[model samples]
Target: MDYIGHIKLVNGQVPSESLLLDEANIAASRRVDLHVQTHDDPVLKLCLWDQAASEFWKKFRASGGTARVVLVTTLNPKRYGVLSLSSMTPSRVFLDGDIQETRDYLGWLSLNQDVANRLNADVVVKPEPATLGELFSYMKRASAKVAWFECTAAIDNVVHGSKWYYIGCGDCHPKATKGPTTLLCRKCGKSEVVGVAQYLAKLSVYDHNDQAFFVLLGDAGEELTGKKAAELVESYYEANDGVGDDDIVPVPQVLIDTIGQTRTFIVKISTHNLDGKTQTLTVTKVLPLEAPAPKVKSGDEVDVELCNEREDLADESVKRAADGVGSEDAKRARCG
Candidate 1:
């Protein structure tokens, strides 16, 4: 049997608000053998979402087809919490954290060494545009007998594949490399890629009353490094008791240099408003060591005496003319 590349049918716009469900139903009717699979899956799989998911399952059951649903999304701990609330049963849900997690997830599938082998289908979910290149590369290198699917908001990004089918809006087809614009899909005109950016923009709004402050790190080092810096600053603040903000506290250069050596230690203090604006204060201080004292003689006392008082001690006549005291040589001669 000849190998067939995986097919990706994207619903670029939300099915709840748009005619995506009606369009998907039409496509499904035409290609009854359609299977869904994620990029990480070794085989094609199905995706379940909104109202069409129920209808698709019903049709599959009626046709004696096995229900294979793949759930791909962010690996939030809360996702499991929400799953407990939902009654939907998927063949298996592959959990991935990020692009890095996708690598491990695919590895397990490719090896056929784990639970992934038992799943009816696998689907990769919530892929970012940056990782698309890596995903395509992995697909090309895989030796497993599997198919792939892409759930992208931008359907024009899909590569051509043997089993590929376009599903969604008429305009949702892949963009021509270059030429006079053609509305018809080069492979098939039944479905095409569409623009859904406008609708997505509306859902970006949030309530201002329940705003949360988030500090985004830009070119900053590791969490440990930041924590160390914060600890050092906290120590300084605590040791000084109540130093004013404007006070110039001398910090040891050795400590400052040691902290600076850590590439990840950028100190950023910030406050956020419900309006989505942030005020940030950066802490930059250099501490230096104290100056050393000059060396001096032991038990030496430096006294400043008047020049006039020292003149009498220096003159020989002033010493001999003194009434009470005489020179030691004169006293010995008079006694002999």
Candidate 2:
């Protein structure tokens, strides 16, 4: 179970980007990333858990950062949006001259230095933490179509009157609009679409640095509340039998229960944020609240001036979302 490849980038050199959390919100072990096939293969994210990640860095640093070629033993293959390798408990690392295998790999790298020297930040590095104020600065810059960041913030309140769920295309999950006798999925260009309920809640969240609104959409909402929007909507109709199926259900108790809790959010900035169309950072992933998470706790009164400018925009977006008539990015039938 050995993986040998050219080391493209090594993270954890700084304080902000050091930690990596899995979808379940648990801290993972160490990792060292690489690409194979003479560095022509797609980038592979090597995630090392526990001490594995730290240990790799320790070895890399000891090599004076001159070691580009690497070989590691015992990697557990994993898939999370992309292919990755997780170092197992017995996993170990080897630098350029650590052993015969690594020496041979170094020989290959020496001959293919041109390929080994190429760097793709997008492929090698994970997103770093950004503050609410910092995200605002990116509005003026032409950045990536979508960018992600880690933010620790407290949920101020669930935005009432905002549509808590969206009616999405049953197949592709894009928001579906009503047609004469069927649902219309413009994204999929399907005239006759089946509809399904999906989570799209809005929250007034704040960090010590700034306060902004977070759109809790899809699985992120499910992660926070431990309930699915579909099931919640279904249970509501079941209790209120006389009500129509299309009625808007208020934010459920499970969601509201999160109002006073502080948690870490993996925030996604879309074209809307980059182009100054909106300031709302969509929550794609939610992390559990713990000691090392957000500095501000739930229901804390943040600085009034920090939120003044962003408030109007957030309210307008919420209104548009409540009516199911916002920008097509309402795949914020996303907060993707």
Candidate 3:
């Protein structure tokens, strides 16, 4: 057995109402014995027997004395009150709560196995109905053997190899909502679709911090001839003596279907100094093509009928290609 020392109650040691006064006195009296007789190593085993147990343990641990402190208290509501008040210190506080009822504390300790194993002192707890289940769940997972003295029948569920006794509750659980309304979970990457509108609203707000905005539209006729359209817009701007910069305004939304496919964009051009007014310009011509065609030999005159038929074939080919189904075999096998 790991020397179970009891801080029993005694009379006249201090004021009658002072909780843990007897335990404190016993601890004080045994300080010298613990230093000199405990193999000169100064490790005295101390336990609590009073309401002031939490305070006494905190002071004893903080005093840098020669004793190793252990708290053995029932997991009653009163014990929880005391432990919760003194919980900020690093020392272990145990509860004599029912092992089955105090499973949550056990679960916490079991989850933090490495920290629990290295603890130098005992922290006891009194288990409630909820705690018993939590503790059993925890014990099922813990790898170390938790030893205890004065085992009671109420907590027979604690097996031989259990390590964590209940300490106390740290915090309460948060409330649940009717449904998830957020797009992303900060904890996980899960996404929800219902909050898309809210997310977009948040993004559009001035303080939203997102700067980029884009509109993806179906293919536009103007887009097919981007270079030609751009040059045409530039010439129009120059001819109109609009603002000097080459800032082309986007085409009106209504014209997107007509101009997008032609690679031609429409923009409204205006200058702030010019009465804050703007005019739309359609840029339809691009840089002139160089070497428009290959010269044919004068003697190698192609037949007129052949030339006309070739032009018709070429136009038909272009139409078929635009329809997204142009095969060489189909063209060869068909007559326009």
- For all predicted structures, in order, the TM-scores are 0.18, 0.52, 0.13
lDDT of each: 0.26, 0.65, 0.24
Tell me which of candidates 1 and 3 scores higher on TM-score: 1
Task: Name the lDDT value of residue 273 in candidate 1.
Answer: 14
Model 1, span 1-336: residue lDDT tens: 111112233232211222223446745543222333444444332334444345443443443332223233321121210111111333222222224454454454456534433433222232122123332333344231122212111111111111011121234322212224423344334332331110000000012122111111211111312323233444556789889744533432222222212111111221211111221111111112223454454678544443110111111211112211211121011111
Considering every candidate listed, which one attains the maximal lDDT? 2
Cα RMSDs, all models: 35.5, 16.0, 34.1
Which parts of model 2 have CA positions greater than 4 angstroms off? 1-125, 142-145, 189-191, 289-336
The numbered model that scores best in TM-score is: 2
lDDT of 2: 0.65
Model 1 stretches astray by more than 4 angstroms: 1-49, 52-233, 243-336
Tens-place lDDT digits, model 2, residues 1-336: 678887765552211133332323322423444443335666666666656656666666676665666677898875432346778888787777888888898888888867765654434334567777776675566534445677778777676654688777787776778998888987669999877877788787777878887787667888898788889998998899888766778778888777767788887776567667667767777875443333454578443322100111233343456334333231211121
Model 2 residue 320 lDDT score: 55
Cα lDDT of model 3 by residue, 247-295, tens digit: 4333322223222111112111112102211111111111121333445
